[model samples]
Target: MAKQEAKFDLYVFHRSYFCGKMMAYMRYKQIPCNTIYATLDKHGSDIASNTGLRQMPCVRTPEEQWLQDTTPMMDWFEERFPQAPVVPTDPVVGFLTRLLEDYADEWMWRPSIYYRWHTKEDRTLYKKLFVDELLGGFWAIGGPVSWLAGKLVHRHQEEKFLSGDGLTKANRKHVEAVYINTLDRLETIFQKQPYLLGSHPSLADFGFFGSMFWHFSNDPTSNRIMQERAPGVYEWVARLWNATSTKLGEVKFDYVVGQVPEGWEPLLRDACEAYLPYLSENAQHFEKGSKRFDWNVQGFLYPGVHVSPYRVWCRERLQGFLNALSESDQNRVREILEPMGGWKPLTSNAHIQSNWDPEGIAPLCKPQKLPLMYKLKSRFTGSNHVRTRRAWMKD
Candidate 1:
């Protein structure tokens, strides 16, 4: 008898950015998987039961274990599959790839959310799409109630990301700047090669694909810009979406490992310039128990941005990776990043010293406190130091 093929079940939503990330990576790797759209009724309940959370784009492995978080899922699959590895083997290139991935995962999220929900056309479009996907055929027959439900769904997103400190008038320019500039830079890269690193897609490609595929390329307003301004990028997104197992294998073998592409440096520099300072300030504020943090990017002040402890953990994770390199590897990475203005933040001590829990619960940031003698000395010296700590929610 023929053996049954191994396969995994992927729970995802069409409009989810992270879901796009996972889908892109899975396609690139040619993993045999079944895609289950996580709707509001029964499939959503199943996902919640499996993961204990409502997070979309989760994978249920053949071992019966359910997993979430696109980054870690990619890592786990890379180890298991070992064919067409997304991460570079060279320490410097690997670290840079991971840094870019982190930037895309956390920083670009603001603009993705903004472009999706901040506009009437895109918001209405997404609401109807989501309603159709979530409610399935009932949406058409339900009539007025379905329309109200879709509106409620759209309003929920607007309240959570649009009306809040997420996409304010004061910071809209900065957010837009990040998206446009990133596209410009990526277009330059794609002009030279098929993928971000070379002929094959890497972690960096999948990272940006999360936002670029779902938000920038799919949203009406942003899609127009992508087609007109960066046709290369739009084409690349299509290529990634339709990649086959044979094509991935061919591209993977065609490229050499440890070789950084031509336009990667400038993109890395841009990420450093745009995201490092924001991350540093976030760490400082989260350490101080503040729910909101603010900073200036590209000479514009973004005030009252909500503090995210999860991002603080991401910063710490980047630092830990940098610190783990061998001395020679670390120096090599520094040489590449130093001129780009990324060295300091990458090497600096995290203001919020924290670690991820074993079971992946809330990451607890350790509070720093002065010794009795130091406190007494500070009192005499009139220092205004105060102690604070907070726990980050599980992503």
Candidate 2:
């Protein structure tokens, strides 16, 4: 008997950064896969039915199993096709890459979605492009729900983003700042090397790129910030998806810290303040000391929040990512990430299960009864601060 050819297909939204993430990996690995454009109409529902989730960037496998979410889907691919590895051979670096990717995927997505869906001007531009650039091909096949479908999907995401509490102006400001700060840091970080992981691109690069490349870079307000604030970083972001490159000057790599130019600090600091709650929530999750916690137990608001041991552990996880590389790479990551001190010493000693099935990421595998919510609190402890010494080895 002859072996059956593998059937690989992606149901995606062209403007979606996660979709782009999957596409980048597919292209990099040279994986043979079919592409299907999913919109907000019946067809979109059809795609969602196949995936058992409304969120996109889903994959239909050779055996016709629908896999949703980027991480699990990517893990599936890594397991199936181990030849062209997206992860580094060094354990620490690989772990860091995954951690950063998670942060990038979850933290940064709010701003990209908000800017695209909320801001009137951005929404207009995006809608026009969706019907023309994104759905042009699908339209040829009589897919008329491009704009409506997109709006429906955007509305769904909006509900989720605004679900926990009504998205306030302060929330918008903070979310926007997340992108700017991330880009500022990314600009400096990438200046030290060609990719986030030194010589080669890792999941972190794509993770950041997922939002940065399509959403921010494409938007006028955010793009101006990226360009004027950190041109090199902005340019480098484009380079991740091969969207931008140098043609004349000799390429160089020299690491530097706190190198953000004048006039950018206020933007970055504002963003930092906005990000505190989200970071705080991450910390609080671990502090709850529950072996397993819902990914969204805490609301990403800008008010009083609690620190969890989980945040510290994750911070250490970031350091672990750096430790994967050679001494030089470790130095590079430390220099770039240390100044922030988001993951410093912790005051609490809490026991949390480290296993994926038993702890932090376990919710992703099982069903949940209710959505997680967090109310503002008056006091918080340093327990959420994770020191560098407590880092774990990526399994």
C-alpha TM-score for every candidate: 0.85, 0.61
Clashing residue pairs in all predictions, respectively, total 0, 9
Best by lDDT: 1
lDDT of 2 by residue, 1-395 (tens): 99867768877777778888887766665567888776533344444334323446767667555665676567767777665466664443444456567677766766787777776787777656655544344432424555564564345445445433245665566566567767767777666666764555566667777887777887876777778888877777656665222231222222123233223333333323333334544555655653333333124443323233434544444443544557765554445334554222211222333232233331122212211111001001001011111211112
Please list the C-alpha lDDT of all candidates, in the order they appear.
0.73, 0.53
Question: How far is each candidate from the true structure, as Cα RMSD in Å?
Answer: 9.6, 10.3
C-alpha lDDT of residue 73 in model 2: 62
**Candidate 2: clashing pairs of residues:** 40-149, 93-324, 96-321, 283-308, 284-308, 286-309, 286-310, 287-308, 287-309
Whole-model lDDT, candidate 2?
0.53
